[model samples]
Target: MIVKTKAIVFSAIKYSEADLIVCCFTQDVGIKTYLLRNILKSKKSNLKTSYFQPLTQLDIVATNKDKGTLEYIREAKVLLPYSSLHTNIVKSSLVLFLAEMLKNCLREEEPNPILYMFLEESLQWLDEHEGVGNFHIYFLLRLSHFIGFYPDASNMKHDYFNILEGNFQETKTSEYCLEGETVENFKHFFNISVDDISSIKLSKTSRANLLELLLTYFKLHVQGYQRPKSLSIINQLFV
Candidate 1:
């Protein structure tokens, strides 16, 4: 089937000397993997390696096949051209870390226009903004809303947040609970938007603690989700 849609590049791996296996989350077909044959060897090809960078948004014309077989892209062009997402150190780190997180969680092959729009617009916002030190934390928390595990903020006044239950409680439920300053910081995120993420100042230690809490929350809620390996690098950059 020939389909043209907007796609977010998740991860690309070289399949051979001349070909690349690119995994993308498409607005039309959800998650699709395309095999770009001879992309590396053909100098005349329009599909350059630059087009497949992590989280680079593109409009693609592609042919889809069976689930396990590789789909092929006839043409692709950058849909939202970013000026500094790949070059700026802070944004680039966030891009790498978020890309890994998305790769792990976005496994469905069904169209989710809401989720796709959220991702595309959020990334574009990140690209156009400055002082995004807290962007990833806000981004991950908001992502939970679309992924079916947004934390219940109705009991925000409670002392503990039960990670597994996705709600708050008067007391701790398990080892996967947040208390003290962590709960306080998590509460602030719910009251703000992506544009205001940086307005809430956080110390290095507090940022690290909140990040750990969010990742733990993801592990408890998201089935089959693994922690991103680039997390440590991202943490260091934030500090």
Candidate 2:
């Protein structure tokens, strides 16, 4: 099947001296892995290695056999080419970390237009903006909505957020819950655009705590979702 859709580069691994295996989350079908033969060393190939960087958006024409075999792209062009996302140290770290998170959580072969929009637009916003201290946290929390485990915002009066139950609670149900000032700060994210994140301020320590809480929520919901190895890099860059 020929698929022409917008996709975000998830991760690309060098298969040999020249070939590359790229995992992309496409707007047409949820997730597709493409084998880019000789994209690295072959100067004759039109597809360049720069087009497959982490979280880079592209319009790709590809063949999806759907026979449990790896797909390959016939043509690809960069979409919404970023200015600072790849150049700035902080933004680059966030890109690497978020790319890892998306790679682990997104593993479907079905079309998801809503999730695709969120990713494409949010990353573009991050690239254009300056304040990004809360981006990763906001990104993951909002992402849970499309992935099946966002916190229930109806019960805001409750002091504790039960991670396992996916709701607010008057009392803590398990060790995997959010309480204290963290709960208060966390709730503010439930209904706000990424651009408004500047209004919600947190100390470096507080941000770290909330990030940890969010990760715990993910682990309980997403099977095989291990902590991203690039986490420390994000924490350090933001702090």
lDDT agreement with native, every candidate: 0.91, 0.91
Per-residue lDDT of 118 in model 1: 96
Candidate 1 colliding pairs: none
Instruction: TM-score for candidate 2, please give it.
Output: 0.97
Q: Backbone clashes per model, in order?
A: 0, 0
lDDT of 1: 0.91
> Candidate 2 — worst ten consecutive residues by lDDT sum?
170-179
After superposition, which runs of candidate 2 have C-alpha atoms over 4 Å from their true positions?
A: none
Prediction RMSDs, each to the true structure: 1.0, 1.1
Across residues 1-239, which tens digit of lDDT does each residue of candidate 1 receive? 88999999999999879999999999989999999999989999989989999999999999998668999999999998999999999999899999999998888889999999999889999999999889999999999999999988998899998888989899876886778997888899997878778889899889999999999888878789899999988879876
Question: What TM value does model 1 have?
Answer: 0.97
Candidate 2 lDDT over residue span 1-239, tens digit each? 88899999999999988899999999988899999998888888889999999999999999999988999999999988899999999999999999999999989899899889999889989999998899888999999999988878899888988888989988877886778988888998888988899889999988998898899889999989989999999788766
After superposition, candidate 1 runs with Cα above 4 Å error: none
